[model samples]
Target: MDRPALLAALRARVGRLERAGAAAALARSQAGVVHLSEDIDAHLPQGGLARAGLHEVLAAEPGAAAGFAAVILGRTGGPVLWIGPDPDAWPSGLVRYGLSPAELVLVRAPRPADGLWAMEEALRCAAVGGALLALSDIDLTAARRLQLAAEAGGALGLLLRPDTEEAGPSAALTRWRVDALAGSGGSAHSLGDPRWQLDLLRGRGSTPRSWTVAWRTTTDRLETEGGTLAAPTRNRRRA
Candidate 1:
């Protein structure tokens, strides 16, 4: 081979090796956990949320659940994919949750099957940081597929569903119920920061717990009253 040709081939081979090394490192994390925040990390068995796993969020109110999911993804550090039957893509509200609409990709799938398909495909993309699906219901098989896809891509997967007294089991690593809480402010007329009651109904190797928290826009941090990552205000037994 000519000198230039050999050099070019060596460069190409080096590039492939670098990519492989990155994938290997990510695969290790896929098999482990991701440190989300100090508040909730210690409570989890893996010391954090599973990096490449599906998590279910039962929405006491759709808006609150959606907000919480966005907050989680904002810390994930990459482009986010949001899929739903019908999505209200309001840019203004997303900024408060720390997601830039410019970096968010929204997919609308009117049919349930289509939405599920989109979610799986998005989750399997290596470049995507996170994927959120506002699903009405998810079965075990479908949930497992999502879990596998997340592992393949090393991305966070979130399923947002309506809260119910009886929610069927799924392949999700954790299940959280988010309820909107009344905001506090100096005056009743002035709007306060958003607040929510977060209930960790179930998580692999973790007991059920709850927290009442608020997002402070001034500091751009979500914290309990004492400026902690998460303060457990209550604990509940699984039904």
Candidate 2:
């Protein structure tokens, strides 16, 4: 099949699956494992965020966002399959966040569509403890399908996209906007500093907030102050 046709088919299948009762059952069965960071709790107001099921983290850029998401999944301490077309150059810093490079299964695809397909197949595999699928671009329909698949598999699905694309409504259970922050180390802090500023754009059963978090590179820890940035009371609806 042609690329467009194949993607359309995948989207249709994923949509049907997401609406099926099995998806909700899968999410419920997989709901107990989410462990939110102290900083995340402060911003969330709800003590902690949901861990199981599919959540979306939207970012203005791919680097910081993908790294931040990696840090979250790294804590699961399970085999992770990182799927992308450019797997050879997968970020090395993921190791610093507690993910053992040896435990990662890298799947390389030739195109964005192929990468999506590979991600679906990998997440469907029960042997995989968790999976992180990085995409350069995706539409609303495709994103919804991925969210469903992650829900069914009980895995964390992180979608990394440009800031321009994230300015809209999505089917993800939670949405996060992350940006770089000043490193905690002295003025000499360089590329690997374990600190970040994350904004919780949207979440279920909670308000939107922002956090100045210290993301430890060595221990894969996320810490933040005891306050949160209140979400705007009124704003334009995302597309």
TM-score of each: 0.80, 0.74
**Model 1 CA deviation exceeding 4 Å by range:** 1-37, 226-239
Question: Which lDDT value does model 1 have at 186?
Answer: 49
Q: In model 2, which runs have C-alpha deviations exceeding 4 angstroms? A: 1-31, 42-52, 88-91, 189-192, 232-239
The sequence of per-residue lDDT tens digits that candidate 2 reaches over residues 162-228 is: 5553367677777777666656666774554666667777777777776767766666567775566
**What lDDT is reached at residue 42 by model 2?**
49
TM-score of 1: 0.80
- Kindly report which residue pairs in candidate 1 clash with one another: none
Q: Judge candidate 1 at residue 228 and give its lDDT.
A: 40
Candidate 1, residue 237: lDDT: 30
Which candidate leads the pack in lDDT? 1
For all candidates in order, the CA lDDT equals: 0.74, 0.61
True lDDT of residue 185, candidate 1: 74
